[model samples]
Target: MRVTRSLTIKQMAMVSTVTLIIVSLFILLQLFHFVQQRRLDYAQQMESVALTIRQPLSEAVLKADIPLVERLLATLKLSGVIARADIVLPDNIHALHNEFILEKPVPALVSHLFELPVSIRIPLYSPERAMRGPLALLVLQADSARIYQFIRVTVATMLIAYLLLALMLTVAISWCINRLVIRPVRHLALALKTLAPEDLIAHQLPLLVGHRDDELGQLIMAYNHNQQTLGSIYNEMYCKASGFALPSLPNEALFLALIEQHSKSVENAAPLAVIVLRVETLQETHTLVTDDQRNILLITLVNRIRDCIDASCVLAQINHSDFALLITRDSHIFRTMRLARKMTRKLTQPVTLGQFQLHPETSMGISLHEKETPHAKELLNRASSAMMSAHYHGKNQINVFRTGNGDG
Candidate 1:
């Protein structure tokens, strides 16, 4: 799996949310279990205390002695289990009551005391009153310390667990996603970077993720399909738009596209090579040669030059005497000047079309395509400027485009 250099913010957020949810659920479960265990313990303790008070509470009710009942309630409270105790009479009278039974045994309580869920226990007593009277209702309450302790410990454990889980999840998800999504994308980006605008061929992207019925997979597939389609369209357009029979050189559209492609390629990438050639001393040769002879000479010269062009080369006539050549990066750009020299030398040889010596002089200029200006016209201008510079400097010379080397 590939890894991306960086994760998009949205992907990071999604991973974070998933991790947070898992951690939150774990914490919630822990807290709930603690609360449940705490409640069970408190219930057991309350039941025992209620049962313990049964006999004494019944005896106190039979005698209706408020003082004894108070003493018993105080002693029970001193045990520190119950928070509040109340013993009522058979007449439903508010009798002996010990309300201090509800306060905490410990002096320090957590500030969020009210946050703890409280449980209440009400005790019903049947006082024997000639076997005819209804029993009194007794009520008891106490701090849920056992339950609270469980909750406290549970919350602490859960908080720690949540923190640890969150950390683990963050690291895991970032790595997983980086491998799954980012890595593949980075690989694709590198491939795209390799693509030159001149590269009409389509490239296949790598499978970053194992094929899954997931959204990311679908997106990758769609993008790859689109690239193929676009590549096809580009090839068709270029084929129909850049080449034709050598004589006419097709229409302006074809020529312009050739220029644009070279220009765009230069802008997107490193410098390319350009050559400008103008027929010098053509008029002098044509003075003795007829119009038909001149036409044939120009046509023959263009054909000869075109023969030397490579696959990714463009040759176009800007005017009757000037032509432009665009080529991919060549190790020997100066070789083009040599080639032009050879062609001019061969063409300048005296031709006898019934006693006519047609000697043509050609001037050549070359320049590197760079990002500053990649337009075909701009490159052509530079080449033309260089050629003019060579022409004015000395006849029949080769020139290379350079900064401040304007045509004199």
Candidate 2:
């Protein structure tokens, strides 16, 4: 819920910013065109009014009818379009103006911004049928006070309208994004709180509702897949790390699986052998050596057994004093005997036992996975039995399990 709130706020901010920008641009453009067109219409209307009265006004001025001239100008002013009307004599003295001011005057800024052409000027003609140039200059200026009022109102209206529009759009879009996108992600985050590696086999992560065919759905699927793979991944790492005697090998749990897989393969079914080596002198040297020396001797024995074989075999540490290896390639009783002797010879070498050099006595055992020894467990049992047999025979020895071996 908190994440949903945070995401909504961020999305709202972005939407509001974009809406404000677009609305501002649109308002400015419309206002610009409206002002230009209104001013043009105002100028045209004023000029037409002046043109309609041109003839009679000129005749009255020629006749020296000052009252008539005043009446014409007053009528023109009362039309409410012309702001001022003036008549310039030859010496340029007499001019008339509409001194009428409105109760609600346009603001000064609006007055300045919408200032029309100073005044439209027209020349008077003579009384002859043909035009003669001589009378007075007629001047008229348009009163845009109403147009200015409309402009002000239009600007304010647009501001209010766009502000409401932007607010509504921001709210709607933020809610949708939070519901569709953020909510699912929030669900995923909550689900991940209880998810772990060891719990994969026991628990299943809950999937998102109403989003089974989208990206979030794919993400949930991938998450469940990750949980599944983690079980095997952690298992593999544990197998590698579980080898205490030799750090690079697996313990019995993984080694048993390895042996089973090897025996199941058709190419590797040519009767493999499980060879185990036991440190016979370990119990006898228990009190004679410290824990550090005993561990060093065991580690050294495992390393020597590794040095005796190559990559064709699978080596693993079964327990404290027992190490197992699988002879997968070129495995027969004769070659197994030779490999066993080699392991026995290598493991019985002198080791540094804290200022004392002592030879570790080791016994090697071998059991082949034939018709009678089919299962991996049975093979390991016979190999262990042979190891016990060699342990009782001599200091360093090699023994192979026969058909009736390990029964005692």
Candidate 3:
């Protein structure tokens, strides 16, 4: 329920990691596709080179002209990639060529008369029947570095484009998350921190900005629900714990009010009872639990006592170990004594704390309203004196203060 800075850090980290993983997977898939495309293009380029030289060699074979074939092959060899070329004719006739007109037989597919742009093993098989007029065989060995350079350039371009796109997407996604999710949560956190423990009226909750069906919307709804629940609890606790002075059991503010009303009430003075209740051995309980746990136990005790009292009975926290109750009715003495006995009895039962159970004790003191009491200060001193006497006597006891007349 208490939103902390650590929660914000953890949420941001989770969202960022998810974004990174998604972007990485997309980039990897695109790179794989790009590599495959480049490889296929290279294969097609190599096939095109092999096909281009086919027509010229076939024409040379049709004419049965060796000199013309030799000149054509030599011209093609100027492409710096051709290694060998051959025109096989019907009846065992052959027109073979090379780059330098080598004296030895040419190797299997490395001809000296064909042109290619990159390193490739291309086997050119004549599409005609074996006994046909002409059959051309072309082989080429080109520079590999040139092909690799082209592929590198193309891949580099694609990668650059992909990187730009990825960066744009990352920015857009982070911005959206910051606006729709992170910003709202931050505002809610700020609102939570500034809230006073006494504030009762609920302020309007902020509305979610983006997709209603999404997780961020759900988070906003959950946060609002939790805030409302805590707000209600705080209001109830604040009102129950406000406006009384302990030991004397007077509202310091209301004492002025009583003074203003004293002239009218003096003609028929009503009895008043002030009860000062102390949780005994609270220091021992403090040693038994953490500060937070001690607060929980003490708050539990306060709520229990509050359930037994009415709204007119002003109650307030006096100290870490005590609470005060002031009743203004004519029957205040009887009601205060009865409620104190019931509350002290209830506290003697064991309370569960994790795996341990603790039994707490209470001591209470009662002081009656005196018509002759000079001020609020005197009333409080007498009540505190009675409470101290009860605590000094023993645990779980109630002592009442009396004037020298011993009437109260």
Candidate 4:
């Protein structure tokens, strides 16, 4: 069985949030336990101090020894556990060693919730009787300020720790997700959206997506494979239908597509020119040379044209003996004419093929784009017509198509 490995941003958030909550709850539980334990310990300490002074306190009260009783109360008050201390007589009389009194009555709810000061009343009995009736009352108020301060500090510390932990977790989780998951996914999505047939043939994918080994990588590989397969099939169909083998340069379909796309862009305001070059002596050269020799000659001719034109110019073998050059708006009429003449001179030069010197006659025709009629097919047709007219003039001739020119 395969276990699916999938993690999303939402899932990450939920997991992190749950983890933080659990940790916070655990800290709170520990804090509560600590507070309760401290409270019990403090209460025990207060009781122990009261017990230690019980005998003296009893003797002083029984003999009506005010000085002795006052000293005992003062000693009891000195203990950190006791916030206040006093002695009370049976006749409803009271003597406070420190004159300690409750400054303000605390609400029951507040006291219960926060565990405020607690008052303990211990009965004093006669020393001889051991269990006789109480001679005096010893009241001790537990010092709650220290415990309350501890509780407040502990709660604040825990809250701050929880927040810091949560922040750190969030940052770490988000960074991991973005690096390992979200970023890759987003990159893949954009790559898919912008994936082109040419890019697939070149085996190009987004940087991160191409390098990954996960599901996104698999998806991109699959897409690239499909695109390559489709491109092969399309090329096969194209060659069969056109009755010509595919050439190294862009096909007529791609050429026309580029022209149409460029025509739509308003930013291309310069004049555009389409130049067609027809090899008039191609058949003669083919009969005189082997297939290999013919290929070399064609390669040499294409290379010369490429050297003469700017890299941005689009060149394509449009037909068996014809080539098309697409000069963008960046070029002017003068530049286009110069390139056409240069191509004519290059192609008409004598080439040595297997001990035989052969010179191929070529005709060049150029047509400038007209704003009123801006179509690729129309421009190509006009250039073709001009090339045919050039063929009528002489070998290695050039012609330019103009509006209302019967020659075109």
Model 4, residue 280: what's the lDDT? 71
**Model 2 ranges off by over 4 Å:** 1-5, 61-66, 88-96, 102-137, 193-235, 243-408
lDDT ranking, high to low: 2, 4, 1, 3
Candidate 2 colliding pairs, count: 0
What lDDT would each prediction earn against the true structure?
A: 0.66, 0.77, 0.61, 0.76
lDDT of 2 by residue, 133-206 (tens): 65888877666666776688889999999899989988898889889998777676776665776665535466
- lDDT string for model 4 (151-235, tens) is 7788889878887887787778777767876777766666657767666554556435345677767767777777678778877
Candidate 2: residue 393 Cα off by (Å): 5.8
**Which parts of model 1 have CA positions greater than 4 angstroms off?**
1-10, 29-33, 78-80, 90-93, 99-134, 144-150, 200-203, 206-225, 242-408
**Candidates in descending TM-score order:** 2, 1, 4, 3
Which candidate's lDDT is highest?
Answer: 2
What TM-scores do the predictions have? 0.51, 0.53, 0.41, 0.44
Summing lDDT over every window of 10 consecutive residues in candidate 1, give the lowest-scoring window: 106-115
Task: Please identify which of the two predictions, 1 or 4, would achieve the higher TM-score against the true structure.
Answer: 1
**How many clashes in each structure?**
9, 0, 7, 0
Best candidate, TM-score:
2
Q: Candidate 2, 87: how far from true, in Å?
A: 3.4
* Alpha carbon deviation, residue 147, candidate 1 (Å): 4.5
The predicted structure with the larger TM-score, 3 or 4, is 4
lDDT of 3 by residue, 166-193 (tens): 6666667667767776777777668767
